[model samples]
Target: MKALLPTGDPREPVVLADVPEPTPRPDEALVKVEAFSVNRGETFKLEAPAPGDRPGKDVAGLVVQPAADGSGPNGIARVVGHPMAGGWAEYAAVPTDALAVLPDGVSALQAAALPLAGLTALRLLRTAGPVLGRRVLLTGASGGVGHYVTELAAAAGAEVTAVTRDAERGARLIELGAAAVVHDLADAPGPYDLVLESTGGPSLATALAKTARRGTLIWFGQASRRPATLDFFAFFDGPESAVIRHFHYLDADTSLGDDLAALVRLTAGGRLHPEIGRIADWADTATVLTDLRERRIRGKAVLTLA
Candidate 1:
């Protein structure tokens, strides 16, 4: 099996290498990966994988070898979700509890996009509580997680204000049913009932000030890669009451499989859309990885296996 490898040099990072196939444990399922998507976290960590290590978390494919206990799908039942590692290869051995059986109408490309980013968005929105008839402020509204937040928030009937630095992405976000789209915090509507913030640092400060009295704010991603500093007095001066929450997705989480499955059903029903921006052959892994590292992709970039 051929999998993408990091060359350990920052100047020229990734290379495709022939790796041995994986073996499944009794509790795991061996999957023939049909497609996989690149996450920003993977793009940031381009260090060379140690021997027997493969990079990638989100993958969708057919379950070639089911768990011995009959806990996972057998035969050709399609599945999609997170893997501990080695998902970049032609096949992966994932724990049966980590995968969700994908629906008939959803393609492997779309399923591959759902695991990490989609789960983060779903969990954060749930943490923020109901937003059916309230103003919601979403920052970093362009990347993988941001795109899902935009669509899911809109589907929940929230009046969404999507904030993105890219004009093209801003336009596309509105098509996802955002009530309003803007480039910065200054341009968004004030006193939001709920804020789904991904851009930390100064953007978080702005989002805090824009939050309505007694509203909730969920900070999930640090895309800006800056330190977030807030003045204690200014932030809690009693003018507007705010509740802040921080969240990050964990791979060993047991509930993620169920969440990913629900997302797949929603997508197959046309209520959720996971856009695949750049589709490249798996042989061109370096190019797709380069585009993700350079922040050149507007939406999720999927690499297809031949």
Candidate 2:
């Protein structure tokens, strides 16, 4: 099997090399990977793995070897969730419990894009509770997870207000079902019932101020690479009560089946379309990661296994 390995050297270490194909455990399935998406977490993982290791978690592929456990509740099947490594390759073995069956009409590329960002968006939205007929704000509404969050929130009947820095992208957010779009945080209308904060740092603080009294603010991503600091007095001592919440999608206890199903439906129905910015061959994994780290790419960048 050919897999991309991260060299510890920060300057130039990522390279594709032939490696041993992973053997599926009794509870795992061997998948011939068709496609995978590059994410910030994946980029970070590439810089550091267990000595010599592959780095990628999102994958969309066909199951060639089902786990010996069979297709029972705990049986191995076409796995889709997290993998220890080897996602950026032609083959990977993943736990059956982590997999979600790809819907009939969804393509491998779209499936590859779903597991992480879609799961994160679904979990964050659920944590925000029902948004039906409520005013919701989503910051960084143009990135992978942010785009999914926008669509999910809008589909739930929330009057979604998408926040982005690019005016052109803001227009696309409206087409994605955002009730409105703004180019800057300063331009965002105030007092939203729920604010999904993806761009942390100053943007978080600004979004926090715009939240309504007793509103819930969910902080999910730190795109700015800066830690978010909240004003203690502004939150705890304010006349109107507000809650600042931080969410990590991987911590959600529920299975991804429901969210994956919903995302599939939305995509199939044309209500959700993942904006694919770039598609590169598996051998170019390192270059893609470098671009992602430098914030030189847009939307979701997918690596296809040749």
Candidate 3:
């Protein structure tokens, strides 16, 4: 099997090599990986390289064998899930409990893109608010997680406000079900029922200010690579009080297959759109990683194992 690994040098973060095939554990199944998605975490991990360690987490492929304990559905099936470290490979050993069997309508590419970003969006929405029938605001509405958040929140019957730096993409977001899309937070009013904040720095402050009195704001990412400072008086002596919560998505804890299964069903039923912004052969893995790290790609970038 071929796997992507860190080179232990920040200047040269990743390298590809022939590695031994993974042996499945009792609760795990062997998957012949077809496609996988690149995430910001993979890019950030490149900063501190670890030699011989596989860096990816998301994969979608055909299950070659079932778990030894038969904990999940039986037989071979197309599945989407997270591998502890070896997802960026031709094969991976994934825990059966974390796997979601993809329906016939969902492609390997689409399934690969959903496990991380889709699950993160679902978990964040659940942690913050149901968002249904509420005034919801989502920042970074053009990124991988943002697109899912925008579409899913809207699908849940919420009045969704999507914020993106690219005003041109706002139209597509509205088509995804957001009530309106704006170029920045200033264009949106404060007191939203819930705010999903992805970009950090100034955007964090904006989300904090825009959250409705007693509304919930979930901050998950720091794409801006800057710090946000807050004013005590502005927060405490404000017209109303608000709660700002931080979020991090760990597939092991956050996903028990329910959310991914629902998302897979939504994709299969045509109610949810999968945003695969870029697709390339595994030979182009470095290029895809660089594009994602530079923020040049809009949504999910998938690498196919040929």
**TM-score per model over all chains:** 0.93, 0.91, 0.94
lDDT of 3 at 22: 92
Per-residue lDDT of candidate 1, residues 1-306 (tens digit) = 877777766555667788778878887898999999988777667755566556789999999888887786866679996886888888898888788998779999999989888888888777777879989999888888888988998888899999888998888899998898888688786788888888898998888888888888888878877999987676665326688888876633447778888888889999889977788888777777777777888789998998
Worst lDDT run of 10 residues, candidate 2, spans 71-80
Q: How high a TM-score does candidate 1 get? A: 0.93
By the lDDT metric, which is better: model 1 or model 2? Answer: 1
Error of 3 at 175 (Å): 0.6
Question: Model 1 lDDT vs. the true structure?
Answer: 0.83
Q: Write the per-residue lDDT of candidate 3 for residues 107-209, one digit (tens) a residue.
A: 9999989888888888787776566689988888888888898888888889998888886578789889889888978888757888888778887876788
Residue 87, candidate 3: alpha-carbon lDDT:
89
- Top candidate (lDDT): 1
* Model 2 ranges off by over 4 Å: 9-13, 48-50, 72-81, 236-239
Colliding pairs, model 1: none
Candidate 3: lDDT of 270?
91
